[model samples]
Target: MGLSSRSVFGLVVSVGLAGAVGAQVTLPPPAPRPEMPEYVPPSQRVDEEEPAFDPSSVEFDPIWTLDEDGKVVGPDGLAEIAALRHNPLITEDLFPIIETILEDRAKEMDTKVFVYPRKAIDALTGAIDNFDVRKEDTRNVMGEIANSLNVSEGLVSWLRDQGLITEEMSMVSFNIMQDYTKRTMDQIAASMPDADQLDLISHQSRFLVRLGLQEPLSAFGRLSRKVLELHPDVVENAAELLELKGRDFLDEVAKALKPLDDDQLKALFKEAYESLHGPVVNSADTDEKIEGKPVGDR
Candidate 1:
């Protein structure tokens, strides 16, 4: 028998619950590196002897000039002077490569900066949800999330105190409130027990209804259904495994998935569908379809 609407909703909620719980897992802090040996002065060094310089073998490659316009004159002299003036060797050629490298490094740093706070928030929320952590901890976590995102939670009160604000300012304030509301809802949902799930859902549904956002919620439901249809078993299996094995299931699944060959995995994926659709007809193959001609005529 086909799954009922209630069953589908339950599945989606179950997945969300697992994600909310899994997000709480805390990773161990990285270990500190060993310190290097202290540096010693050349005069007091005991490691090795310094090499003596040979004055006879030394060569000087001096810059050439004709004493006219103080310009250098020699093979590649113009290029060398230009290199000194503009640092062309570093700027024109290597600068792009250096800039690209720095940009990539900056992106990585930004990712870490964003990710660490998020992880901390998830862990904090999870603790508050499951372990009955203090309300103050939740505030701290929210503060960290705001700080990491470069957002201020005090904007709502600040806007209100302004007495009169622009439409754009009001919209921005509304957006912040919406974001905060969504995040609070997630935390509330995460904290609730299985029995409270329906209650939480009902509360959220009513909230959405009051805000006239039921249509968007329905659209999201439709989009989720489409996604489920595309990969039916993966979602079901993941949910099932998460429920059975708890948090460690993902690690186990990752390890298990690593050994599967591409062809084997493809075969498993193909099994999800009862029958594959035939290749799409190209525009060049037949103008009949494009011209609204009958399939039989084609």
Candidate 2:
């Protein structure tokens, strides 16, 4: 063993060559460490069998629903639909009231009753019955005004610009105005003698003509004119009274008329009627003129 130096040197060289060969061999990166799943408590774990999102499974609320018009299906919309469905203008039997009012008028007028065409009664009756419809329309308009940022906000802005209305009082005024209008409508509908009022309107030839011509809104406007002509003092102070105390104004108006007998009422109606239509032109007046003419002129 001591004499084998050449053999020992060859063995060392073989060991060095094996180490170099192992270093030269490239190994793939140790397979990336497998990631651990995040720990979840038993109570917090989502079940694997749970269903995915489904819209139908959710509860429906009409308030949140968008209608065909892109507006919310709110309580107001529902009420309007119901109101239109049950409106007396469309649904109620108005013919009975019309016949009754006509019969009463005929008894009073005798031969003169024939002068009023059936169309006049139809117009007046329709207007009276449609009062509820008009009220509903007014409520909708007011609701729209209140809901619209542009209109309501514009009112506030305009009031501020005027320097007459304080910001706090502007909204108060708006609310009060709405309340006054609603109360005024209620008083007029409840206290004004419906039958007598109908009769009063029946005598106004111009009012009937206007209503028959499909100018109901204009006919209503002229009603205010007639009221002014009849009671100028009452109307002059109406705005102030309405703002301060709206409920009693129309009641007082109704009470004032209670003292008049039939003859007195007819006289008032005649004045109003004549003022509205002028003197009734007739063939008799024309005949008088024609007969008075000179023969040669004729």
Tens-digit lDDT track of model 2 for 202-285: 334222232223221222223223444675564345444333322233233333433445454434444444456555455234
What C-alpha lDDT, on a 0 to 100 scale, does residue 288 get in candidate 2?
43
Assess candidate 1 and give its lDDT: 0.37
Question: What lDDT score is found at residue 14 in candidate 2?
Answer: 92
TM-score of candidate 1 versus the correct structure, residues matched by position: 0.18
Summed backbone clashes in each candidate are 0, 0
Candidate 1, poorest ten consecutive residues by summed lDDT: 213-222
Query: How do all models score by TM-score?
Result: 0.18, 0.19
The collision pairs in model 1 are none
Model 1 lDDT per residue over 1-298, tens place: 9999999999999998899788996658999988988998888977567654332232223333234554333222121222222321123554454444434333322222222322222332342233212345544654443333221212223223443333333444344334434654565466565636556665554333222321112222222232234554544354444343322442333333334455543333233211222223352332233233211123
Per-model lDDT: 0.37, 0.36
